[model samples]
Target: MKNVEPKVPLAVAGSSGFLPGCEGMRGAAALGVLLTHVAFQTGSVTESFWGRVWGRFDLAVALFFALSGFLLWRQHARAARGLSASPSTGRYLRHRIVRIMPAYIVVVCAVLLLLHEARGASATVWWANLTLMQVFVPYSLVEGLTQMWSLSVELAFYLLLPLFGWGLWRLRGEAARWRVPVIVTIAVLSLAWKYIPVPTADGVHHDNWLPGYLSWFAAGMILAEFATAPPPRMVRLARIPMLMPIVAVCAIGIAASPLAGPPGLVDLEPLEYAVKILCGAVMGYALLAPIVLAEPGRHHRILASPTALMLGRWSYALFLWHVAVLMVTFPILGVPQFSGYMFPVLVLTVVLSVAVASVSYALVEEPARRALLRWETARAERYRRQNGNAETATAATVTKASA
Candidate 1:
């Protein structure tokens, strides 16, 4: 079969041409998550209109999942389309582990050791949180680390992605046409998983698991597929001025309404949960589509700016630390939980979280990533040299036999 080059847009093609706006979106998503947590803690989520809007900012988690799906799956998509070689599963897993675990483990340890409520936690609790397995066990979520369920779900997806990529790699000829449809079916089934009867147990929250949110990730994966070889319809849609942003805003507005269910800790009905899931997927996709599809422009430039890039670079650490910072802020400021100081608490938390996150990124995350990448490079070079020598010896033997 002839290898066909995918017609990827220049804005999102090679490494140098990757979308800068995605960095901005990541920064924005991190801020959204922090803001929502602050609103909930300050009792603003239940008190005011803006608070409700802030509450819906948990949609940022969907955005994070979507971004992960797109960015991580792109290589697989390219490989499926014959644009590039498939990524090595070992190297991919190594990169994913190094990218997330160093800073994550540091924050998990710090939170468990430092937080008053976590001081008396059992070893099981420590093990669960450290391994990002808190969501699997009932009652394992520590106070300051309650937000890590999403991270656990993310880790699950990371472990599962290589298998999914292998499946994609198996598509050949006409079978490749089913790729998008198959992914869409999986997304639908994942959403339907929410309706399956699972009895509630002490501290068990089924919604926190990966199944409930796979659709959001699938949305990004679908976009990744589209980006690799955009269909005529997608190209047309991307060219439509302001279409995606408008859809994103409208989805958000609907999500903010009662239709998507009450904010905070209230249990939602099945229908409400489905609505929230659909809205989140739509909103996240809408927000990200333009960045992936459109040509470079003012919006991209703004998002690609130095400040936004820095925020994006620090976004993961910021996410890991914000909830902990928010938890400590109430005590340090002498404000009671749910006491009405939303603005002040938000300000303080943002300031402290950013400071801590910057240090974590600089001293922990970046260094670990660089060190592992260097190791991977060295390992690859050694493998190449060994393979080269083996090939040379085999050729010599063949020549001698022919003589």
Candidate 2:
């Protein structure tokens, strides 16, 4: 496949691996999660029109999944094409672990120890979360950090991407185009699987499992193909600035409607849930595509700013620690239920969560990532040296025999 010149500058232009405007999108998504929880905690999310809008913000998780799929698929696509250096499975796992684990572990410890949020859970629960198996291990969610269930699904996607990419890359001749269809089939199957009744202690089904959310990830994968090796039609469509916003508004409206879901929707009839998932997936794509595929600097201008990027850099930490911050802050303020102090409480929680997230990122996440990367580099260098020495010795022996 020859490289196709992009019709316009991409988000990948100025930055090397980092997508330019995506940090803002991520920050916004993380804030959306915070806002949803805050609204519910403050007892205001169901009271007004704005509150209902904010309550629907749980869709942000779908956006996060889409972002993960798009970004990870792009990395794997580059690796498959021999364009990226760190393509080995070990290196990929190392990077994911170092990037995700440090801050996550810190938050888990804080919730269990200082906050005493999950004082009742057994040792197995702690181990399950530490190993990123919370979703699989029933009743393993950390007390206030229930949001980490998304991380479990994210981890599953990380594990599966290499195999998925390798399989697609190996397709030859007439079989190549089948790759997209195969992925689409899997997404459809996942939605069908969502309707299968499964026994749970609680009557309501927990859709946190990967199968239920695979469509959102697959939607991102489809966009990733467009970003990396777009078809002519996709390129033409991406150039149209008006298309994305119009699609976004329509998709959001549909997702917000009674047909798809109600505000603060959790448990839904199976058919309604499936429809809601589809609408959410479409909305996620609309929200993300403009940032990803649009002409550089023209679309998503507000999200392109430095402030959003900085917040996004800490978004992971913010997502991990925000609930714990809420759990602790509420008690110290001494107002148990909804009250006049609710506004102050919400403001204080945000400030505290940000402070904690900033410190966690600066001290733990960045350092751990750099250290592991440096170690991997050194290890690769040593292996190269050993291989070079063996090759040189073989050449010398061959010369001696010829002489």
Candidate 3:
């Protein structure tokens, strides 16, 4: 058998049979990001040790990348094999743009409008922020809602994925095989981060500085490719012996970091970054392993439950739209000072996230996905029919001519 065969996960393409644990992981990661957002917004980082811990939930950004990588690869590998598709990179790009834009536009505009009042910013600032280029162009966004950086990175990844996916798809020849290509690509991207002079505002520097977080995305893509491989013992070990404790430790670790303020003693930066990066990556693995490797069971019952699935399904919309919603609604309600009662803010965040997400997915992302499938499916059918007719017509015409 070819080396590529073993790399393909036994699960059929677009398998809804995913271990629900993955759905749980999505919700959990989204919530983790929400926590980090709240912590960042409050500038409560030094307020206490707990604040510090909550601060680290920001690592959910990594978890989000990893999970997206696994699923996108899983689906694309199964679907990208038809002539009509031309691999349909154009369609893929369109779908991504449409799926993400409506809600994103709404949210970015809402934030800008709020900022307009709060800081009297000019339309130029609004224009740059709305376009998502500010983060790359060296303009600092409004301080309060600058969490858009992660969104910027995610948008950048979305832009490159079809091209990246196409390149990897082309490597699926008989000789070099998928495994070599995947491993090589992963190693190269990772090493580039370690060595390449990635562009920055300063114009020349390696990716090792700042959150040159692209390496993690490449890691995620690598994981996605490998998920198709035959199950290894390590894959099983991840969910059982490995993943559980790792997630617990990460949760506890973030829970302990204090918010920013004088209430904190000396900073834990030395040990803090260490624990978060290490544990965060591990937690990301644990979250993904079950979905990628384990037998489908409602093992994460809390997550696999119907409500969570709905939330998970629309989580992206929910996340993109929630910040603006919260910003608009919270102040109007005269939100009380943060303290032990802060849980209410979290509740509002979840509710609004869920509401916005449900609307966005039903009206926007889902319809956009359906449109792509319909267009592509029709195009594929046409090509098949045209090819079959050409073959038959040639045979008939030749017989008459021969006669």
Candidate 4:
């Protein structure tokens, strides 16, 4: 894990329609969650200010799910590209495991090792975290690393990607041109459910719900398809109409939700998993809006501007490192005093997280990421070569028999 470069370029960089803004939105969303965790734990006046300004950055985690779906949607757009679905969904799953687990294991260990005093029972927390089932398990994992719930959900989603794709494919036939309506219907149903308030525990809050998020991935998959062959008219339309509603909904959701309750702003928790899923679906829409409505070009250069683009690129690694910095920072600041010294902690967290993440990209995630891709591609090329050789041998036998 020194500063090593990728041996092979990532497929998405040149091949997929994974334009810069998507990464920016994801990283920005991840950062928003980071701020929310900082605010929830340290309780600074500035954090309070932020919580009110945007309904707590915590709510944005749901948006991440939507972004996930939108990004993956591209893999499905193959028939549109004159190719069928890949023969093995298993390969995609293995890549996901390889991509996520390795760096997470490395970073979590580093954080726990660095900040032992900030939390208790490090051994047990580490165990729960490894399973990615810590959230469901009742016990807390990783000291003050409370932001892991969303990570657990994301891991679960990765497991379900193939199932999701199969279900989507079966819905209208993967090759059907009319599948757009099917996606819209599922998305709309999920969105409408957001209106119903979440039920209370002793009247307490449990913000996690399943239905609310599916729509986001579903939407992501839909758009992922477009990434393969983005429509011309949709790309050229005014301001990404597909994305507008989702943006509007998220803004409204935050505006309506409250933090630090007298009874805490009525939690949107009760609505069945469907509505939030719908919101996520819409989020998928917004993430892909710039590209789906049109291929990015001279007019769309704003979406990929250098400053914004750099932030997006570093966004994922930044997310991995941020919480640990906050945890160790809190004990130094003393949690009680964090409220008054909010400005310093916020600046410190951002600076350290970014620095650590830049290092993470250079050292751990990127290098391993490239090696895995190179290995996979090489295996694939060999398979093709072997298959072609067998076909040639079969043709030779037929020629000899005819003579």
Candidate number achieving the greatest TM-score relative to the actual structure: 1
> Could you tell me which 10 consecutive residues in candidate 4 have the lowest summed lDDT?
256-265
Give the best candidate by lDDT: 1
- Tens digits of per-residue lDDT for model 2 on 190-290? 87655787765542245777788888898788776656544556556655767866876676566666665556646666776787678668877777776
Off by over 4 Å in 4: 1-16, 44-50, 77-87, 117-124, 171-178, 184-212, 225-284, 298-303, 331-338, 388-403
User: Estimated TM-score per prediction?
Assistant: 0.92, 0.87, 0.74, 0.75
Give the deviation of candidate 1 from the true structure as CA RMSD: 4.1
Predicted structure 1: lDDT: 0.85
**Per-candidate local distance difference test:** 0.85, 0.74, 0.59, 0.60
- In model 3, the worst 10-residue window by lDDT is 259-268
The per-prediction tally of clashing pairs is 0, 0, 27, 29
Ranking by lDDT: 1, 2, 4, 3
Question: What's model 4's overall lDDT?
Answer: 0.60
Per-residue alpha-carbon lDDT of candidate 3 for residues 1-403, written as tens digits (9 for 90 to 100): 6565455445422133365666767777777877666654445544566766666666787788767666655545444333122346676677777767766776666666554433666676667667765565554456434556667677777777776666666555342236435644554444334334356774222332334454445445555554544345645565575465567565546535432112322333423433444445555655566556555442655777887787778778766765555555456556633433346666777777778778878887887788878988999999999999999999999999999
Compared with the true structure, model 4 gives a TM-score of: 0.75
Candidate 2: what lDDT? Answer: 0.74
- lDDT for model 3: 0.59
Clashes of 4: 29
